[model samples]
Target: MDVATVKKKVIVVMGATGAGKSRLALSLASHFPAVEIINADSMQVYRGLDVLTNKITPAESQGVPNHLLGNIDPSVEFTCKDFRDLAIPIIDDVLSRNRLPIIVGGTNYYIQALVSPYLADDVVEDMAEDSRISRLTDVDLNDINSASAFKLLNEIDPIAANRIHPNDQRKIQHYLSLYSTSGILPSTLFLGDTSRKWGRADNFRYNCCFIWVDAALPLLDRYVNDRVDSMIAAGLLNEVFDIYKPKSDYTRGLKQAIGVREFDEFFRAYFAADSSWVNSLTNDQVSSDDANMFTKPKLSGILNSHDSNTLRALLIEAIDKFKANTRKLLRRQRRRLNRLKSDFGWKMQYIDATKAFQDESDNSWSVWVVEPCVKIVRSFLLEQPGFLSSTGAPYNVLHLTSKDLCTQYVCEACGNRVLRGAHEWEQHRRGRVHKKRASRLNKCQRTFSVDQQAAKSADGELNSTFCNSP
Candidate 1:
């Protein structure tokens, strides 16, 4: 019997942040016989920073069971593997009860790991335990300079280095760590196997129906900015303040949340400039106050009470940066989704919520986004034709990608900008910016050649006269 036929069903709701993924998932619960939502969001797993992480409230959950959400310790590092290990049993239990498991979040990797059984990183980790392989126990990530680390990676495993940016210290360190610990080149782990690169569609653990909630960039930009302001009005600053500690590592755990580090400079300046305010907001004093007292209005009143023009300015700048970073994250998520659909050939039903977002009405949402998604999920559950597991890989540029993944291109026209893979290099070469820069450089070189020729001719004339006179 085909595994696809026996495989259980799982619905995945994915989107950029602020795309209303959680809302859609909750709405989905009412239509099903029994539904349990497992969170795939990396940050939302942490216990604290509820408002900052944009966790769904108990009231907002609409009585549907939500697992792995706001339940983990904030200080501990929770990885995709950890999420996968925890979520699989929960999903199995949900399936045993014949309930639908709906995985929802902005975190794509966690979803991928749960659905696909084969992943490169997981395989490499398994291989690391071989007794023959030597381990480097003394490696300190902080001491490894970005340039030197990348250079070392290029020397040892140029294929891996080619795929990663020189400035991507994390990936560089990861590849180096794998090499040192496993005694194997990171690129060779795949052995040019395209299926294991990220995770192949053939090794799917369950029958998954992917629904991507997307919006127009212009509208999404506006919505996210408004959402950030609303978050502030809903006490985003209070959440940040609660998590704030001097010199806390912003790169780890819940501190990695977007709103957390953006306020670091503002908070530092605010406390430094006002000793009295610092005294007023000590842990004991803050604890004594009503939890709701730190609302946006009260915080604003407090800031205004002090001589805090500079502090207010810093706060405004931080808020602006937070909004800007969110927009950048939106673009990156959009790009990654496109890549998953195109390069990896994941079958995803794209539901454009642009009109729904524009109208901002429940009626519009039900008609535009919810109805179509419900229909798709209904078909998937029934195992209708064309709604079965997506095992067919789309014929794409992926045939060339195996080698391209190990190739690097440096653009001389763009002041030696490095682009990974042939596809990116081709895209860069065809871009208007690169074309204009190349044209300008070519014209300058031609002009310089003419000037040099003219100067030589003048020198010849002067030399001829001097020779005749002598």
Candidate 2:
């Protein structure tokens, strides 16, 4: 079967949040003589935020040697680069021990970093010595507007600047700092450096299979909704409430999990609910200052003056928002995976997991999941392009990694531009700001739900969920 046809190896299972990629990886471990699964998930690296993050349970590990799960406190920072630094050595160690390394995670960016080339720590340290970024860090970033800063960056490093979005303030600032400190543009430094340079696509160290698990949109929507319901039934609310602090910043590591942010409006109301109605919702007292954390203006506006009935209604709405947001994230993940294939020439073995998922308590997962995965992995390793053609994914190019696809989006209606990728587009299309502009421009009736009106506007039906966000 040419199972060993691939080079120094690793197996990465990547997919959306609820697509069962972790389960598939564990099931596949049974076929290997020895395999260690390393965590590449950004959220799962945090110690708490377990149920909300949909962390793999101990029962689900199946006695497999798994690394990096729940290893850090949620408050600390972790980045894609940090993930790559931690995972690459593990991959090397597993290979030295004659064991395969299988990395399964919902974070595609982390997986990309794990496999792609990067600068060595020493080289990075060397670059950091008297580096522009190092100098700029101590300066007040707020003093410069993003537009002016990006323009300055463009003058200094137009090639890199063109590739980086103007709205990406952090990257723009970094570029400016690099130019100011090193006296060389970032693009020039990256390309021209001959000694101890960070790795690029041409530098990836492993011969591996990147398994992309996906499903049709309707099936994915159902899966996300069902998972959200399961999370609730499994006490997701209390799990979040237990670890939550009124002062916790969402910019921190684990706070970025989809479940945490989507439930913000409800938590805010519960925190600042009317004293007369507070007992109806909770036995504990909450401070009004906590209300400052409520940032979603649309949702906040709906629950004006948080009364008992209002809090209860917002609770139901939070559930729907959670489902909607998760569904949206799944869609975004699919888009990113496709972009990964296009940009990095990732040899993706696509799995329609909705078809593979089954109710088999007595039947081993090998039959339903592992067998099919083995077939795909073997085909990929053998370089049998036609083998996966029948599975709707074919190995074509096995190439190097490049920068991620740009995330810039421009709104013609409102001049609301962002570098936040698909979510920005989703929010703009589904949000009230754009709809209001459209209503005034086209004279379409301003309705309670933009999705309903959009469905009607597109065809003669209401397509997506009718939950409207203004």
Candidate 3:
């Protein structure tokens, strides 16, 4: 595949957790017909953490093939610098094969490094002088707040201070220690007359096509909630339990993630219980009512026993907060994409799931009704042997309808046929046919559920076929 012939050059999909980076990445990889995904997430690189990290499944990769995921052990301490080193070679290999590289993940810094060649070369060497760096252990780093770290960085290098956001504690600490020991700032080092040749632009080069898949705040929130639920269903708790050492740095990061952190708390609660006490309690085989009294409260109260409800509530709360944060981060990303479009004069397309499908239908003469989840669509695409072209485009994207729903014919109350095409579907939603039916259904004295009405309406009969007719 010639680079010039490609629609998107080197695509980068970025968003917060559960914003659908993996799904978008896989979708683009399948659609672009020339794209290979390069995992930019820090956690996704670790092995044995598919559920916790939301790592793309083998089935979801769709034979499109991904790099840098599940390559490192969770116990290993992999840094951003290590990512850059590994990524460059993989990118080069992809480009050499005439394939496009689509970088995807929530790790903002990783994507930043890849896109900004100047920053990629300004590597932070290991902190020397055991006195200063040793004092700033991983534990210390985790404990320090961003504000304090920013203050320290300002004292060392004001120029770097202005460049880095105060809220970004990780980068602030990294630069602070890097400059304090080396007596040279990253900005100074990167911009020095002799240092220009060492940067990514000077050494390696590739044109990029950046597309961001974004959703409205409401939709994004719902998506995030669904994503957390999916992660839990996929056994995220088990993954966290397998690596829940109190002293480990791995636990710290895991604890920071939304659903995983809740599991950590639950694990702590369980471990704190005396084994002998638990054994005695189990032997007693208390009545259900007695067990309830001893167990912890489900929602928000102290518990005398080991109840799982508290853990469930914690997980739900964590997921809600995570979704809110993810929406905020996605908005920031949208702003960045707009800024990049204005500055670089590159073609940047902002397409959510619905828009992407519409665009595909318009451009390729093929229509698809993709599930809300990207993983499902990706899995469907990749499972077909030879489904993807040599350049990595999906051969055929299938649009599936629910057999149960499709078996029915037209609208019930108004005798209107349910629109089949995307445009027709939209038109039907706006027209009086659906509106009148909705109004009548709301006023109906029958206690039939909305789903029952829909099923009846789908079958083209207003007579209680929805309730009586299966």
Per-model root-mean-square deviation over C-alphas: 4.1, 12.2, 19.5
Query: Alpha-carbon error at 243 in model 3, in Å?
Result: 1.9
Question: Over 4 Å off in model 2, which ranges?
Answer: 1-7, 119-124, 130-134, 137-202, 274-308, 357-368, 379-470
Question: What TM-score does prediction 1 earn?
Answer: 0.84
For candidate 1, lDDT tens digit of each residue in 129-237? 6736455566665476789888888988787887788976657877787788687778766664434445445557887788999999999999999989989878888
Best by TM-score: 1
**TM-score of model 3 vs. true structure:** 0.57
* Model 3 lDDT per residue over 3-43, tens place: 66543235566654555577667765656577788998877
Misplaced by over 4 Å in model 1 are 2-5, 129-138, 143-152, 177-184, 192-197, 276-308, 386-388, 392-403, 410-418, 424-470
Rank list by TM-score = 1, 2, 3
TM-score of each candidate structure, all chains considered together = 0.84, 0.68, 0.57
Give lDDT tens digits, candidate 2, residues 166-192: 766656765665555554557654453
Question: Best-fitting candidate, measured by lDDT?
Answer: 1
Ranking by lDDT: 1, 2, 3
Better of 1 and 2 by TM-score: 1
Model 3 poorest 10 in a row by lDDT: 397-406
Between prediction 1 and prediction 3, the one with superior TM-score is 1
Q: In angstroms, how far off is 233's CA in candidate 3?
A: 2.1
Query: Against the true structure, candidate 2 has what lDDT?
Result: 0.66
